[model samples]
Target: MTQKRDLENKDGPSAKKVNLEFKKEEIEGFFNDKIWDNKFQEEIKEQVEKSQPYRWGTITELMNDELLRNVRQEVLNEIAFKKKETDIYKVHQSGDLANLSGLDWDDLSRLPSLYKLRAGIYSEEFRDMISRITGSGKLSGVKTDMSINTYTKGCHLLTHDDVIGSRRVSFILYLPDPDKKWKPHYGGALRLFPAIVPNVPKTDYEVKLVPQFNQIAFFTVQPGLSFHDVEEVRADKHRLSIQGWFHIPQEGEPGYIPGEQEATEARSTLQQLQNKELQEYDFPKPIRNDIPADELKLYRGLGQECAFSPEEYSYLRKYLNAQYLEPKNLQRLADVFMEESLVELGGILNDELAGKLMDSIRDLEINTKAPAHSSEIHFPWKCAMPPHKQRFMYIDGKESLEASEEGIKFINRTGPQELPNFQLTGKAATNTVEELFCQICSFFKSIAFRKWLLFLTRLIPTSDQILLRRFRPGSDFILATSTDSKLARDNTDEINALLEATFNFTPTATNSKNWESGEFGGYELCMSSNASDDEDEEDDPAIYRESDPNDDSVLYTSQCKWNSLCLMLRDPSILKFVKYVSVNAKGSRWDISCQWNVESSDKDDEDEDAATS
Candidate 1:
């Protein structure tokens, strides 16, 4: 109320205008004089043209400091922000600032400074200046767009190129604590990533800009190339900013073209779904190599037996809960899985192994430092590539390799081997986490475990790939994606599906106070792909749908838990993702994930048929 009272007298009569319009002559009055300087404008143009990774530029003291400060105050006091989280981002965002012009007098009166700020930003003078600096051509004054966002501790926007419909420029005007310097350690920097090709972003960011109050960062929206992400906020402070985009001129505006917007949309990142060539650039592709002949034969033979052997029981007892080994319990599990196609088992590991794992993970979280940077991640661990889709640390039981243009192409063309082996880590595998994870991976891949899985699911695995993964707090996640279409092609004998299993070893207590309610993220979610309808198939598969509670689209929600295992039969139509871990999480979401191409079992189907009769 005091800020509003102060603003009422600051601009007097002009502030009450129903349709606020910025005059060309008043440019210097609304923005910093430095931006209007011709020499400064040319320097900015040059800097943007030569910017590394991609074309981008920044302006410090971009707006009239006093006016912008007043606007920030108005935004903080008058605007109501709602927290929204999806697979791609998490932030508290105010409703679109573009609607400020439509507000009634009573509502408008509450945010005069914010209204003035929006008008000044979309003013013809400022738009021209931005256009010239970024060489993004003409920008429309009519199609104004903006929203205010506050990135408090744990909030983030993951890697994305600002390419949708007719967007020419993207900018963020920072409004943090004006008097204090925004530190790099606070972890709210705007990071830019290089692309291996057009659509594939590199595993690591190549550049970052730590923003301060009144500093505006802007870039030309290059399809697939201009990739960037907002690093997660780690400090208990608001990193507030007004984010907006300048679109190509609309009809009746200067430089408007009849079909330019359509042309731009045609080239958007979403179009990659229809382009098979671009799909090759994606990393950790759903390339599940065919199972080795001998291995397949062994599993098929074991599937005929109803129970485990003495040798098999001894091998499994080293890792599995004793109760799960009981024939009656195993039969019950198989029956449940056959009916529902999925099951979640808690206390999955034996007491000794589980205790050792929990202790090692808790120690890693409390004492040893986690790798916050890609370069710091060493042996037995590798960072997943192409940050636009996923970011996490994993051991795929192979030699660690950097993602290069040649490497991406090589893997795409030749295809990698079917099974993973942890022997590549050698001496480096001695660390408790690595050692335990390797044993787990090996256990999942072992013939003994395959036999157990066969009796439990009545499906024979034809191929397998196992990974020991750590989704670190604030820095890792896999965006929602469906199983690869290739899974269906792996086997011609019967209807094939991916028999997937995740053994969670996250040390966080699963109570509501910690991770159970999903506030701190680190949840693995599975949903119906919704790809059945012909109309829905055209929708971008990567976009997260806000499912209605009554809808059956959400198949399962697995919160971060300690010593639990989730088993599911995944067809190509099931979508899944691990939610981005918040900085507030107790530790990383630790798990060994296993995937196998499984042939449907006629035996289980007949048993169900008989029971129903």
Candidate 2:
């Protein structure tokens, strides 16, 4: 018997005029009768198990011939002129995936015709049949979200579940070919994975469903278990489908409460899992250890040790752009420094102005240094030292100075004339805390000292770069101005006040501390919420918990030192002989270091000898 005729006549009983009231009763009766049928229940259970994803597929012939033809023509027309990007359309609805709804519905429009086709498939009669077969009662108020998905040869969708807010059932109506089967090799097969766990599963078990014209597939969104993906299309063909959901109706409708509750529970569980995963991957490794050896070698080749080649210059011009100044401009600056005395004079001028001119120069619009000519130049310019080998130094900024037998060589460029000189300095000294602080102060006051300190700190041998600490056993706390104290507490307003009072410069606190230090010399830094602390923790909820002293953890020691140095640098009222300074502490012990390279324009010929002495 025809499906339509069977629905009209029940149990061989027929009437001249079918009552609309009787139709509702008939539909409800059909659903109730199938609710407990042992064979039907077994069919569903077997399908859910054998399919492994609780989905079903069926092909309906000539559902609506003329509408189908028009829709096919429209899809072809859209694809022929489509841009090289993904496009989507939605039927109107409100919720998390609301972008998939509220499409314009004029019959003459191509999209509205597609929408009508979707509405027909999700019609009251069809939904009632689905509800009866699935043992879900009295289906009414079903809404479908339909869209045409055209996947080019390279396009594919990554795995995701159709589960969304208030979605009960998900279905896809296929329109591929009216005469031929949509084969697996075409690479648009619907792939489904059985749920073993939330967000993670054993990938050995999976199933594939190839499409045929007028075929439909439906499944329940079983939270994380129902993972699916669209296989990338291999052939130059369009895979069109009207995808949608069967939703529970608004309040006062039957069967609405149960469906709503099911959706709520599923969404809540998914969100909890998402939050937990986010916290796990927050802090990445500090060192670039994961980079491959070949890549690292390539990066090292780009250092300052190598001379710039034509190709390198071209690349720098293209990639680094405006940062690379014209060769003529560099020559002009070089010509101004023709006299050796000018180099020394510039250093003396910097000392006379103390910090004022240095601060102004730093803030000046002109580009003082040439663009790094090659990767060889990068080593000398490495501003922040690695966590290991971080310590204080003092030296003269004389470019011609020779290295000691310990391989500590100093090449100074105290004046702006010559290229920035560097030295290969040996290990740091194990001086007393007071002596180290004194050296730090002297280094900041002397231009020659600044040059040597800058080079030595950056050139420590890789093997000897063991992390160091200055520990004081008795004293557990250090004293500083209220400004410095507020920084440790992360008070922005106080930090700004300190900056203004010291350097006469102000910057917004958008950039956080780049490095941090803790007990036993642990150090690391990056833009992330996760970092280790050294001090003891209290019950204050506003402050982050401190690191455990007993347990060894790497703290961002450089960040702590940089913060101290930045505070000192901001004060233009102080000496300007140094370009950088940092402090390191463990327990009560602390070491402060300063570094600067001179600009030649500030020195005089007579001052050169005194400066070197």
Candidate 3:
């Protein structure tokens, strides 16, 4: 019965063409005219050429203040934004503005300033001006991709060289609180990392720019050397910006080199990281298992239901948290483990011991300055090797001392290594902080704990690796990996021997609430393996996100919390990683990660053996 009125005067003779001329001066008013001035353009060009890590540049007051301020207001008033968290970033993103052409006039009227800015960005005068300065060549005016984003407290983006299917340039124009200055200490700075080689980035960053309203930052999309991250925002204020890319021209467009995009993809960071020679550095060190005869025998006999022996219970009473010692709690955990293949136990340590450990660690973190280099950390605090896959402080039961470059080279060059049996479990002799951690590492290797684990999961360890890990803020993490390094046996579907656990020792202050919004950092995430049969054996999940997290593939995830112990009877198909601890994290995410070569009891094999008997 009702019809919406069209914005067009359909009966008018000129309605079909509707050429309302937008003057050049109107477009010029959208940006700072000085940017197009020859002298400034040359300065910008030279700055890009000399930039560290890779070529990149930023211009403050890039757009006229009033116009950008109005654009920011329009965006905040009209756009719906949602928090999107994935492996690479945590940000609030607006719907992509790529289809601005389809917007009804009423909607367009509300976003007029945003349209003006977008148009100015793609205007020939601006595009060519950017091309000549960055030497990126001409850009495609028909293909614009941009979205508004707000990174409030805790939001961040991990390091990545933006070499995806891109035409040419990557850019971000900030629209943070105009009246306030975005300070460096407030944390959301654009940080750039240098490369040690063409594809490998140095552990630390060399360049950073604090965001400010009306500032525009851009970089040529180099394959690997352009490693960068958006530091977690720490202030109460929001750091809003518009980010997108300019593609190399499409067909029928000025800069369309026929095979340019394909050639660029060939040299993409994803491609570079997948190179054979480069994979020698992937982490979760190449260790395999060699089940001891005695350990294998214990596993076979443990059967469907098992429990800690009286002596083993007594031994644990002195060390473990009282709650886990309760038979009911242990039984509940066992039931869950049997059903889901994973379990979480809270209050896993005795209060007195936990208090002492907490006090000692707090004192150490406050008093003992952590070493500047991985090699500088003391014996028991050996740093995990290879920055690409993971980097954190850890001490193995074998007490792997600080790794040397030469030793790392040896490990990488050597073939698959064997996991150590608990032979060194009792070697630790002291009670100092250094020895305290070693003692726990040894405890993980102890026959009593091994027996308890067997009673709980009916899984026996052929060999074990215990690590005391310390993830400092802004510093550590493990990228996901699938180790089908162990062969699937007659009794199992996958190499399900990896019984892994994380005994979180983070203080009460850094619970999920502090980082649930993900600003403060230190969360543990797990996903189903992304490993493909087609990719080479050397391929592992990229330290980057392979796909959107919303895609149903993520299996389970947890954030850092105090006194919680996580157990996963993992198959080689399970991929796991600890999210990077932001520099803004209140404290280190401390934990003991234990891995065992477990022989889980298979129902079919047990039934066959029983029937035969």
Candidate 4:
């Protein structure tokens, strides 16, 4: 039998073998003179110590120019990268470089430049200086983790605080084309988000570092406070980098503390649970409950064969296409909705109304500019808060939350306690978009539509919350995760929510060529709620990747399109999100998002009968 030893402690044979690989002088030139110079170390250390959002720093011209350039070329020539996407990032990645240690000598010899770079990064000279500079305590020499990643056009990393496992310091060494300068306008900048509270990050970023070739950016891994992300690469270029971590010392190693690692892990876990509790305070508040039987009957009395009276159809004809209002087409659509719990209807509006809407929206885009940052977005449109959860522009008939730490606390106190009344406030006809949106919301609340929906889905909606959303190009998305089960639980005695709807009012989102394969997002996606025995689902579920495309979980994916309406039954465990709208999208994805609390008569009455009998 083979024996296992504490390699992490640096006492084992593995440590000795690694120690012999690189000499101090060969790798000393890798760092800039200022970094190692005894005279300048204190100045740099002080700067890193004082930095905001959280303590972090960057160093330019890291590694010998010739050696680093050679390493970049060798990597491009030797490696195959697979697209690795998760809730965190979308990037092309090479296999972990740490695996090199397991390869035979011959295989390892084939990658001489990489071996040198790895050894240089872990050198005693660099390690001690990094430890002292970041005040991160001693880092382990035996357990190293690293991999190469390339962020190409449309690639991005969302907000996360690196607090997993034994990692003490997280670092990235950028290697864009050595010969060409990386411009700031090209996107792919590393942005740091400051905290509103310990775990809650402010909506906007405080610091942004444009990456350049031969630059190294790093920060000590502080749970909750160290929030950061890679902005999407907009230009058609690759931002390649080596990403890795330095770990706290392991058993028997210098500066090793027996309980420190476990303590850090426990604290991170506890903070995550606390963070979830804080998020609960931010969800959309709903008013009322399932409409009473008498109230439901009021809508049902509108008549059986169709929802519209002759006069109502005449009024609706001004906007809706007559084909959709035709009896045959309505029956077909209703049948489809009954079985699938979903229906996507194109040409939802009459050409005259469609043309007016399209022209109006196009004019709005050209005349009144959209905000570049979420916070800068004007009222009527409010920025969603604490971007760690989601980022988008929306109108929910409630006061917008301020974007500061105190603002978050204030908003939390006001609470989304009551369901909103868009119709009450929406009655004031303002701009074209507002008028159209208000019309839609009011129509949803009408007796005729309620009757129409009841006949189609066989579920009576009791209450609703409607949001007019503008998924501005480049900066809007909702991360994957479901809402609280309790929000919809009373409708069904079981856990699932009965229904939800999104009326896509986008007038110019039909980029069928791009969205067909999801190459450039702007699609709404939902999956069947995960089963109980599956691994405990993450608080923030990982983004779905094509590599492991949902075998059967994906319930529906509605591509960006104009005048399309989608309705679906909601499952409490189901995860959903609006795929981040790409900067290159035709225009903002406009939609009226609605959540419904629905109940069915036969099922409720049958259960009541059983109880009485």
Candidate 5:
């Protein structure tokens, strides 16, 4: 046994004897200068654009008899034992072919020849040339970090964008069929797509490329729309490639600045936008009915204003009655309004308030069941238009005659006895009655509610104001409006009180028509403040406060699945009620108009021309 072991050890090859005969200087020149020629660059670019998703090729000259044998052996020895996922040891295969990745020397590895080649390719001269050609200062002198995936018979990668992180450019160096041309029928074709939008594009727009040895393909990562997928291999052949990036390197590189400050700032802004609360848009639905009794009560009374301290509103003499109005005490009220388990309400509050709230809800239900009064109409006043456009109307029992260009018109309503019109010159008309009320409460706390009462006086004509009435399904349609200026001053307080009172006595049912009309389908909450006619028109009145159709000024609006709920006041003077107005919208995935700027008008005009032509 000892003699056999000695003989085996003597015959075994030493580690040093297996070192690669890689010509570092030669390989570096190939990547840095020789690989990218005018004809080759044009061909690759055309192929990438033609391919629906991605296109890549490899350099054939480097995959020669001596170099290929030595490189393959070194790869199998040095990389096979290392962590497979690391940058240095990547195994790539498409069909039967496979190769190791990341042999660059400037990285952690000490392979002298490989290091020399990597340095040469990433040298200043090469990067400058690239910068001149691509017109991107961001890519000059970029270092690449990449990993490889080996594919067998059924192994395939689905279509996806390689846009994650800060990848500026992507390229693949082919090593398959050193002598033979990689034909289109071979199945390992790189595909690219023309971007229709940033992320989504026409699926049929695609191009393909059949790679050859000693060839490479590169392209920019166009976020959103640049999507590509690998086609499955049909034949049993191995395809190999060296894929890498031209990174915007750390500190010492040409584009690198003191601390990467700009990149950091951009990332922070993106995160903030992503974390903001979804605005309630169209439908108004209860968002937090499951809160604890006390908490719910507080939230119900204060709305979003609960976030502020009482000290903030000390200027106004109103103190929150925590006992009755705080969120903690409102759970019972919420449950009752929701028509949920009565037993649960009893556990949260003494049977007293719970029973009272429930009774009020039941009363509202009873009123709803009574024969439709001559004045009452369904909640949603109009059907929505496909793509963009929503309409809502309310009719009350009271009647008012208005002199228009046509003639005197008598309008009926039941909600308020008068339309509370305050001369709000720059204010958004679509701001919800509740949101305006909250702002008033927050800002005018120091000033007596009566002092602010004067503002609403200028809003509407005295004759029109008298036409307002309380919203009554049976007798009121357009006749109801608010005449009390003082009550209007504390709009937030008044609206909350009204809502609480309404919830106490009214039980709102899930409108069957609402469900059948596809109102709740695909609903999602979103917010927009731009004064776009298309967007404003798409809002549902039940959830959105209808703004003055004539007002084209910009105003912030929150939307939910049901409708849009907007806060009209922009004055800093009325900031007090900021938290009080909590707009609720139903949860549904509804389509929203993407028109936000004046550019959409051009598109509209073009569309009109097309139709006319």
Candidate 6:
């Protein structure tokens, strides 16, 4: 284990000289002399200008080596870090550095190197240099923003463009072990993603930078173009770094433009809606296809009668537990579901099928290596796109991979032809994990199971989609988001909520404690939604309120488990997310997720009784 150290009590040699004031001449001494070289400056500017995906650049030996080393030492010794986990990120972080200017004498003396480092970073001369290289216009030194983070194994940040508020430039200075070189496989690379248009980030990162000690990476805060993430730290080593942003020029600063910040905020609000065309760019779009008339007629005819035919029972018995199929048990479960609009069944699958599934999944997990890159993932399994919203590998019953715009259009188009037919695929299943999951998908979509579902929930299925998802460790997650407005709209005559179910099949040894601790993520969480109607200042849809674990807003949290199913009726006000699977997880989070547009089974009966009267 790594030994812990506290902040040094002794002041450094420059501690007495350093104060809250910034001097132009002093800046040159703080940074490497190469930074002031005309040739180096021009080359860096050119690099930023020609960079792909977005304008960005990196500088090696960014600061005075000794000074930065001391800064790193002081940070590790003095600052206490709190573990922060949210929909988009998970890491240990120190408090905001914006208050460094007001620190009392004792505190200031203790963090002299840190204070000096901060001053050097936000000095007028340094900000001007950054402004020129990135061509992002003048930045305000007064509004200094910075935070120190130590991303040990399992820490990660999901894809997002840094477009919040008045941020003009986003930069990170690496402070990992100065003596050793950081390697690519260590997994703390800064990955940059290219966008399909402006707001939609591609499914995978095209470029990544593995930072070394004293290296700094910075980019202009383009609203949609500057999409990036910190790849999960796969190695058991501390990856220390300082993250900060240079803000737009403030009222008293040079190059200050009145109302510029407000205009940017307004534009950001417009971008959030993404317009209708942009919505098309999102993969596995929220648009649920309407059910066919024949299925609708069948479901309506079965109203109030939860009875299953012998043939239907036989078919369902192959997948579901025998007890679940018994009429008394079904009615008892239905009573519970009806009262709460939710139910979780343990050992949901029959012993024969469940044992086989657990074995196959375990074999696949232990014997076969999971794909590390998006490109390495093969068909039947496609990577989810527009990764800022979600990042996971899924089998959505599509025969061919469809990631292009034309492909999205074809899949999302109105028609029963585009609807998934997992049964057809299950016919060819070879008992592999993929085939077995496909079979599970088919079971959920089966008409016989729909009748069993009607008994369990008293809801008539209108339309459905079933997905087999694999949340791989260190790579996949779904951020907090609510049901699509179109599907969740409150209509007295129509469905107000969607019936959802998740069949968890994460294989784990009985004694393993990783999944239960919630330390390795891969949990499904649902919270009361805080989405607002105000366009100009909508709440951040991705982050939970500072992500307090004890907050009552979290309605449910289901850990990765084996042979369990969770059923719930989700309205528009509910937010859900699959936490990012940590690299330390025992295995991938395997599950079959099913969704349906459903109406109350009693609705048709009431209509018929009124007509008869």
Q: Pick the TM-score winner.
A: 6
Query: Worst ten-residue run, lDDT, model 2?
Result: 459-468
Question: In angstroms, how far off is 563's CA in candidate 6?
Answer: 1.5
- Return the TM-score for candidate 2, rounded to 2 decimals: 0.38
Q: Once model 6 is optimally superposed onto the true structure by TM-score, how far is the C-alpha of residue 403 displaced, in angstroms?
A: 2.3
- Clash number for every model? 0, 40, 6, 4, 137, 3
Whichever of 1 and 3 has more lDDT, that candidate is 1
Worst lDDT run of 10 residues, candidate 5, spans 574-583
Q: In candidate 4, what are the lDDT values of residues 1-613, reduced to their tens digit?
A: 3222111232323322332355677778766666778656677689899999788988888788888988898777766688865434678877667666554454445566777888888877888888888888999987787888899998988777777667899899999998899998888999999887777777788999999999999999888788888899999999999998898898988989999888877656235734556663343433334555687666534444666778777866766678877777888887897777787778777888777777878888878767877657665567765566677787776655666666666666765644455665465545687666666666766655666666666666776667788888877777666666675453344324747778787766655675666666768887655522344532222232222345576767787778877778876667777777778776788887877777663465578899999
User: What are the per-residue Cα lDDT tens digits for candidate 3 across 1-613?
Assistant: 3232222222333312311235778877788889878999999999999887788999999998899999988877777777776555678877667645455565566677877888888878789888988988889888887778899876877777777675489899999999988888898899898766667666667888999999999998877677787888877778999988888898899868898878876786656755767665443354545546676666667655546778887888877876676667767888899899899887787887778877877887787766655546654345664455567876554435314445546665664454543334334433345556666666776677776777667566666666678888866776555556454455543344578888888874445566566555567776776633334432211234443455577777777878778898877666777777776676788888877766555655777899999
Q: Rank the candidates by TM-score, best first.
A: 6, 1, 4, 3, 2, 5
Error of 2 at 37 (Å): 15
> In terms of lDDT, which candidate is stronger, 3 or 5?
3
In model 5, the Cα lDDT at residue 609 comes to: 94
lDDT per residue for candidate 1 within 1-613, as digits (tens), equals 3432222123333434376566676655888988989999999999999998999999999999999999888888877777867777888887667777766576677887788888888988899899999998999998877888899988888888878877899999999999999999898899999988888888788999998999999999998899998989999999999998998999998999999988988987666534678677664555555667897777655544467779988999999999998888888999999999998899999999999988888887898878988889886788886687788998887766657888766665665643557654534685787888787777877788887888888888777778788998878999877766766563265455788898888877655578887778888888777623355333321253444323577788888888999899988778888888987787788988888877765646677899999
- Between 1 and 5, whose lDDT is larger? 1
Q: What is the lDDT of residue 213 in candidate 2?
A: 72
What is the lDDT, from 0 to 100, of the residue 517 in candidate 6? 86
lDDT against the true structure, per candidate, is 0.80, 0.34, 0.71, 0.72, 0.31, 0.81
The digit string of per-residue lDDT tens for model 2 on 14-104 reads 2332211224443333223443456864665456445566554343442455566566665555222232211111111112112212322
Error of 2 at 309 (Å): 23
Residues 389-468, candidate 5: write the lDDT tens digits.
Answer: 11112211122222121211122222333322222311322323322222322332222221211121111100111111
- TM-scores across all candidates? 0.89, 0.38, 0.81, 0.87, 0.34, 0.90
Q: How many clashes in candidate 3? A: 6
Error of 4 at 569 (Å): 0.8
